[model samples]
Target chain A: MTSSNNTDTRLMTGNEACAEAALVAGMRFFAGYPITPSSEIAEVLARKLPSSGGVFIQMEDEIGSIAAIIGASLAGVKAMTATSGPGFSLMQENIGYAAMTEVPVVIVNVQRGGPSTGLPTLPSQSDVMQARWGTHGDHPVIAVVPSTVYETFVWTIKAFNFSEQYRVPVIVLLDEIIAHINEKITIPAHDELAIIDRTLSSQPPESYLPYKNTPSGVPLFAGFGTGYRYHVTGLCHDETGFPSSNARIVEELYLRLNRKIDQHRNDIIEYQTLDLDDAEICIVAYGSSARSAQRAVRIARQDGIKVGLFKPFVLWPFPGEELAELTRKAKTIIVPEMNLGQIAHEVSCATRKDVVSVNRVDGTLITPQEIVKRIYDVQV
Target chain B: MSFRYEIRLSGSGGQGLILAGKILAEAAAIYDNKNATQSQSYGPEARGGSSRSEVIISDEEIDYPKAVNIDFLLCFTQEACDKYCVDIKEKGILLVDSDYVTKVPEGKFTVHKVPITTIAEKQAGKSLVANIVALGIITGLTGIVSKKAVESAVLSRVPKGTEDLNTKAFNLGIDLARELK
Candidate 1:
C-alpha cells in the first residue's frame, strides 16, 4: 500500500488514520489539541488539510477544540476534533451544546488507561459506558469502536455518516492499541465506498421548527448561515428552539431523541458472532480484546471444545437486542475487557443470564488462553 | 489439509515490518488466491520503538482480525526477539537478523540467524533491503509462499529505480537460507 493507492500509505499511525478518514469524507475544518495517545491525529491534520483546501487549528485546549468544531459545523462546514479520556471529559459541556443546537460534528476519542493519565502507551477499553453517558443531559452520541488498524479506516467513515445523518455528535472510540498500531490496509477509491451525506432541511426560515423531527425521529438540520434563523439554547427548548417548560412539548421531544437511536438499532448495531450455533460458552468482547477472543475460539475448537465469540463494532447503541437473542442458546457468557468488567455489566443487564467477566486492569491485552481457561473453569 | 498461520514481523519502527506483512498478505490473497489480512500496532514516536505487524494467510476466509500466536516470528532487534520469542507456537520457526541480532534462543523449533543486514549492505548498498533479505529467508524456510508472488509484490511496491536493487537483496536472502545447512 506504499503509494500504490494513489496516495502513499507512508507509514501511517492510528492517529493519521482518523485524520485521513476525515479528509476523504469531505471535512473542511478540524480543531484539536495535543494529548497523549491522540496527538498524532492533530499533527497529521495540521499538515494534510491545508493542501486539500481545509483548515486545521491547534486549539489552546480541548474546550476550544470542541467549540471550534461546533462553530464550524453550525456555519455549514463538516467539522471534527480528536481527544483522549480526560480531554473528552473537558469537552462535554460543548458537546452538550452541539447536541442542543442539532450540530453535526465528529469527535474522535483514542482512549488510553485513565481516570487521569493512568497509562498513556498501553491499551484499555474502560470507557465503553462513559462514551454513552459522558456528555450532559439526555442527548445521544453515536460511538463506534474499531479493533484493528484496517477497521480504523471503516469506522472513521461511519463516524462521519452517523454525525451527518443524526445532526448530532458522532464518536469514534479507538483505543491506544489501534491508535498507535501501524499496518497495511487497502483503501478503495471514493467511487467504491458508500458515503452518507448530511441531511439538510428544505423548509423556509419562517416555517422552520428547529427541533422538528422526521419520521425517522432525526431532525434534518439546516446550517446557521443558510438563512434558517431558528433559535437555539442550552436550556430545554420548544419546537422553535425557544426555552419551554411546557409538559407536552418537553415530553414529546425527549421521547423522540431517545427513540431515534432505538428505531435504527439494526443500522446502528455492528457486531460479529462466531460459532454460537453450537457452543456451550461464549465470549463477549469489543476492540482489541475481541481480537484475542477470536484466536481463543479457534484454538478452543481445535482442542475439541466448541467456543464462540461476539465482538461489538458499534458500542454506543449497545447491541442489547442481539445479546438478548443470543442468550437463549448459550449457557454462559464471558465478557473480557481492558478494565475490570466494564462491558460485562451491560452483558449481564441485557442477557439476564449469569455472565462471567475476565477483567484486566494493568493496560495489557487479555490473552486468548485466559478466555479459554475461563470457559473450561465454568464448564457445563 | 489447510493451515491457519498468523505470521508476525517485529522490529524497530523503520524496519519495514508493516510493508513486509502487506506484501506477504497481498501475495497470499491476491497472487496465491488465498485469504489474507494484515494488522499493525505501533508507539507514539514513529522511529526507534517496538513495531509489530500480524498477517493471517489461510486457504479459507479469515474470521479474526487479530493474530493470537505466530507460526513464523521475524525479529530484527534484541528487544523484539526478547519480546516475541516465547510467544510463538511450538515447532514454529524463529527468524532473527544475525548481523543486527547476535543472541539466539535455545528452543524446540529451528532458530535461523541469517546475516540479513550484511547481505543487504553488500547487495542493495544500504540496510533498507535488510527486510527484503529476511523476507526471502522467510519464504525459503516456509514453503507456503512462492518466489514469483513475493518478487511481484516487491517489484510493484518499491521505487521505480530501486526495484533491481531490492530484487538483488531478496534473491540474496533466498540463496543465504539455502546456504544455512
Candidate 2:
C-alpha cells in the first residue's frame, strides 16, 4: 500500500525495518557477529550496505564487533552493531569504552531468553537491566525500546539521532518477538524526519579540546583525520582530552559525562499512554510486553475496569518522571515483563508505589488475558 | 466494535508455513489495506520440529500479534493439527492435509480434509509449492482475505521465473476449496 505522498508501505519484520532505518539514518559502517533474532539486521546490511557505499563487516566476536563500530565512529562515520544477549555480554567492555570516550554509535540488541546462551530461538526482556548497566562505571546511557514494527523503524532512527545529538552510545533494545513479528509500516520520506549529524569542532587545530565541556555539557567531536589532534582514552580525562588523575578533574569528568544526558532528560525521554484519563489501574510495560498490555487495557476497558497502558519508547531515561506523575491516579500499578521483574523493580523504585509484577520468562509471550487476570486479581 | 480474525498455519519447520503466513498477512495488510500482524515460533531444529505462524488481521490496530482464539487453521501434519485444533474458536474453519493428517482431532470447528501436498506435486508439478496451495485453500475457505489480494501478494512474493507454477498451484487449490465449499 502506497500513500499519496509516494512513501513506500510494505510488510516487514522489526529487524528488517531497523536495518532499513539504519541505512536511512546514514549509518555508513556496521560491524556485528550474526546472532539469532538479530542476525537479519547484519544479513540485510551486508547485502545492502555495499550498494549504498557503506561498509558491513562480520566480526570475529561481539567484542571485535563493538570495537569496530567505536573505531568507525571515531573516524566520523555513522556506525552501528546488532547482537543478542550473549554477544551483548562480550561487548560490555567496549560499550564502556565508547561511553568514556564519547563515541556516537548505535547498538541494537534483540534480546532473547538468556543468562548465557539460554534459549536461542525464544523471546525475553531479561536484558533490561543489562542494557542499562551492562557496561561498568557510572556512565549515562540512552536506550529506547520499540514495541511495534513501526516503532522499531522510528526508534532506530531516533536512536541514531540521540547517539549523535549527545555524543554517546545509544542502545535499541528489542525482544525476539518484535524482531520476528511482521507488520505493515510506511517508510517516511528522507526529508520528512529530522536526522541529526555529529557536531564537528570549528575551533583552530591548536585550540581544539576534544572533551571541552560546553554549556550543553556535550563536547564537539574532532574526527581522527580532521587536522585536529587530541588524545582519546578511557582514562579519566579533562577538557584537553589528556589523562588526568586530579581529584577535581576526575569528579568533573564523571559529572559532565552524566550531566549531558541528565540535564537533557526531557529531550531524550519518550512515552505513550492510553485510556489513562480515568484509569484506576495502570499497566506499565515496554517492548513486546507492552503490546500485550495494550490489548489487556482494551479488554479491561470494555468490561469497565478503568484500566490504561503506559508504554515507554525511550526506556533508559526510564520515563520515571512521567510515570510518577501520570500514575498518581492509578490506585493499582502493574508491571508485566518477559523477565523476572527486572523493570518492575525499576517501576517500584521510580514511583515509590507498591507495583504488582507479572513476569513470564518461559519463552512464550505473556498473553493479554493474563494481564487482564492480573488486573482483576488486583481489583479484588 | 473491533473486527479481528486470527489465522494459524502450523506444520513441521521445512514445510514453508512461515512463508505462507507472511503471504496471507501481506495480502490482508498491503493489498486489502487492513491492519495485520504475522508472527512465528519454531524450535531450534531447522526442520522437522513443530513450527507455527500466526496472523491476526483487524480493521482496528492489533494490540496482540498472536493468534489465541483462532478463526481458521491450516495444518500440514497430524502433529500440528493435534496440537492446535484445541485453540480453534467455536465454528472455526479447520483445513488439513489428508495425506499427512490421517486422524483428525474432534473439535467444535468444521474440518475439511484435502490432499494438500499431493495436489501440489500432482497438479502444480512440484511439492515445494504446497505452501502456496495451502494459502489458496485458506483464502478460498474462510474468505478471510480477498482472492485478488492473495493473488497479488503471491505473485509479488514468489520467485520471478516460477510465477506460473505458483499461480497454477494456488489456483488449483482455490478451485479445490471452492468445490469443497
Candidate 3:
C-alpha cells in the first residue's frame, strides 16, 4: 500500500539517509552499537533491515560491531556498521582486521567531539586523522565525507561500491551537525542507482585462492558456503590465505593492498569545485564546514572578491591532485574545519601553497560570517 | 525575487517543536516545491529542556542551514520566547503561545499572542498535537506554504491512528490564525 510518507520527496536526517542508502546499495547485514549522532543510523537500520530480509545485530560493543560486519562480508553479504567517535575508537582494531583481510564493508563514523567522549551531543570533525590512521599498521582506506544529507545518501552508496570494487573497508565520515540536521531529499528509483557487487572467483573450489592477486591488485572473493573453502586471516597471508611470515610474501601482500587503492586513485577520488574558473582565493572544506564555505564564497562574490570553493567528498586517498589542479590560480586556500587544521595540513601539502586555517573546536559550527571574515582578512 | 526565509520554533523538548519544524520544511520543499532545511538544538536531557528547531526555506539552495537572523519565531514557552526573541530580524514576526507565554518582551518585531495550547486542548481534545496546531497556524498566518501542502505534510508525519486528531488540531489552528489576522 502506497502512503504519502512513502513519497519520493521526504524529510530525512543524514543518518537516516545513510541507513536507507545502505539498504539500497544491497547491504544485507548490519552490526552496530548505539552511540549519539550515529545512533540514528543503527536505530533506523534495526527497524528497516529486517523488513528487507536483512539482519541487524546490536553487538556488545563497537569492536564486536565491526567484527560482525567483517564476518558477514566474508560470507559474501554486503555489510556495514555505524558509530560515533568513542565507539569508532573501539572499532579501530577490527577496522584494521577488515582492512588487512581485504573484507568489503562500509563503516559510517558520525563524528562527535572527542579525545575520549569529549562531547556526546556536539559535533566535531576531529576524526579525520582517526578514520585514516586510527586502524593500526599500514592499510589502505577509501574514506568519503559528505556535506549534505543528499550527499550522505549518495556517498553511502558510493562507499558500498568502492568497498566491494576495491575489496577494502570504506569509511563514510559524518559530523554531528549533518547527522542530526533534517532536510528534504528525493530518493531516486531503485533502477536509477548504480550498484556494484563483489566479484566472485570463477575458479572451482579446488583451484580457487581467495587472496589471489590480479593485474588490478584486487582478488576475486569466494565467500564461505560457496563451495570455496578458502581460509581468511588477518595475518599477512598469501594467495591461499595461509599465514605467511616470508619477507617477500609479506612485502607483496602489503604492496598489493596499497596498490589496489593507489593505482585506482583517480576513480576513487570525488570532489566538487564551485566558481573556480576565475577565482583568486579558494576555500577548501569538507563535510559540514563546506556548507559554511559555500555561503562565504557566495557572499564574497557579491562583494566582488574572486573567491571559490573546493569541497572534497572523498577525504581519504585525499583528492589532492584534483584540488591542486582546481585551485591552481588561487593565491590562498582557506581550510575551515570543525577540528584544528587536520585537512588543512593536507591541503597545504597537496597544493604547496599558502593555506589559511579557520578552525573551531568549541563544539559549535563554523559560521559563514566567520569564513567571510577570513576571506576579507586574507584578501587584503 | 530570490529570497530566504528562516523560521524558528522553540519550546520544551517534549513539545515536539522539532517534528513541527520537520513538517514545515517538508511542506515547503516537497509539496510547495522549494529548497528547505530543518535543524534543531536541545540539551542532553531528553525532556523538559529548552529545545528549538529552525527551518530555512529558500528559492536557491541553502548554503548555511542554521537560522541566524530569524524571519519568524514561534515560542511555546516563556523562557524560549525571552531567549530567542532578540535573534529575530527587525520588524519580523514573533509568535508566542498565550497560554504559556504571558509576559511578552517588548521588541520591534510583530508579536502575535497565539493561544496555541488552549486551542489544541479545547478544540482538538489532545494538547499533545500542539506542535501540529502551531504548524497550521504558522502556515495560515505566513502563507509561506499552501494550506493543502501543510495538510498533506501533517498527515504524512503524524503517527498512524492519530491522523484524525492531528488534522483536527491543524484545522483549528488555521481557524484561530484566521481570527487573529
Candidate 2 residue lDDT tens string, A1-380: 22313568889999999999999999999999999989999999999999999999999999999999999999999999999999999999999999999999999999999999999989999998999999999998999999999999999999999999999999999999999998999888789989999889899999988998899999998898878777889999988888999999999999999999999999999899999888888999999999899999988888989999899999898888789999887888999999999988888888888799999989999999999999999988
Distance from true location, Cα of B95 in model 1, Å: 3.1
Worst 10 residues of 2 chain A by lDDT: A1-10
lDDT of 3 by residue, B1-181 (tens): 3699999999998999999998898888888888899988777778898888999999998878999989999999999988999999998898999999999999888989978887788889988988988888898889999999888888888889999999899898898789878
Q: What is the full ranking by lDDT, best candidate first? A: 2, 3, 1
lDDT tens digits, residue span A1-380, model 1: 34433543433446777888888788989998888788888888888899989999988999999999998987888999999988988988988888767788999988888888677666788777788888778987788988876678778888888888877788899887678655455565777766887778788888987788689988877788887787778777877889988999788877887787778878888888888878878889888788778877887888788778888889888888797887577888999888888789988989888799998888677888788889888875
- Chain A alone, TM-score per model: 0.95, 0.98, 0.98
Which candidate should be chosen as best, given lDDT against the real structure? 2
- Position B97, candidate 1: lDDT: 86
TM-score of each: 0.83, 0.98, 0.96
Rank the models by TM-score, top first: 2, 3, 1
Instruction: Show model 3 residue runs off by greater than 4 Å.
Output: A1-7
What TM-score does chain A of model 1 get? 0.95
Model 2 interface Cα RMSD in Å: 2.6
- Is candidate 1 or 3 superior in DockQ? 3
Q: What TM-score does candidate 2 reach?
A: 0.98
CA displacement after TM-score superposition, residue A176 of candidate 3 (Å): 2.4
Please provide, for model 3 over A294-340, each residue's C-alpha lDDT reduced to its tens digit, 9 standing for 90 to 100: 99998889999999998998999998889888888899999999998
The model with the greater lDDT, 2 or 3, is 2
Taken over the whole model, the C-alpha lDDT of each candidate is 0.80, 0.92, 0.91
